[model samples]
Target: MATNSTPKKPAADAPAEETAETVTKSAPARPARKSAPGPDVVGPALPAGAEPISVTLAHHHTIDGTDYPPSAKLLVSPDYAQRLRAQGYATPA
Candidate 1:
């Protein structure tokens, strides 16, 4: 009688399957800028032929009960009044 000499083989294992999902991200939003006067705010009101006027903050005097301190005024062109409106400045009465 002849004996078997072949080596025994291990059982085959089942293969595993995998699934993947992709994700996307967006950049953060930027903050808004505030509208305010600054040191660089000094400039003429408007171009030529636009208007010849100026703007200044309201001031009052004790003696004559009149507006003074013209330095506080913002020398602007006539149309600058419109710009002031956009800037939320009240129109003079």
Candidate 2:
């Protein structure tokens, strides 16, 4: 004679507990949100006694991988103008 050892039925309350555990395990994690900049958070401020500058920027046209310079005018702050000159960029005489 052979005998079977499997349980005939599971408790009715067992399914509810298993469902809660499954839901917790499958839950998605929430991402952290970044805060937006405030009204006071502007870009870098200019130093004291800094002056505005004005200059002409030569426009260039590219044709067949070659660049040809053209005439153009650019108005900028004096400090920025000096910086450009230091970087070897100057207006035409």
Candidate 3:
């Protein structure tokens, strides 16, 4: 009968083992980023008629898959702009 007492060693080709906690701890934390300001489209007042007019958003909106951030200027129909203004969601640009 024979006995082996020597502790087994990792192979040279084996990669270093890391636990999830250790990996997470070693990773650098990322800081929160502020969204960049949207474009300024505020233009001259529209002539008195039924047409699209620019309005500044008071709240965020997602329309037709496009995101409209607060304070962003958007061109909308007169009726729609009126509705938004009445709801306090937008103001004339």
Best by TM-score: 3
Clash total of candidate 3: 0
- Report the CA-based lDDT of candidate 2 relative to the real structure: 0.46
Candidate 3 lDDT score at position 12: 94
lDDT of 2 by residue, 1-93 (tens): 988998799777674555665667765676554332222211234457764444544444332233334443344456655654565454643
Which pairs clash (backbone N, Cα, C closer than 3 Å) in model 1?
53-76, 54-76, 55-74, 56-73, 56-74
Candidate 3 least-lDDT 10 residues = 36-45
lDDT of 1 by residue, 1-93 (tens): 998999977657844444342234457776554333433223443675664455554442111222334235554556655655465452362
Estimated TM-score for each candidate: 0.28, 0.29, 0.44
The model with the greater lDDT, 1 or 3, is: 3
Output the lDDT of residue 35, model 3. Answer: 47
Q: Which residue runs does candidate 1 get wrong by more than 4 Å? A: 1-24, 39-45, 49-76, 83-89
Residue pairs in clash, model 2: 52-77, 52-78, 53-76, 53-77, 53-78
What TM-score does candidate 2 reach?
0.29
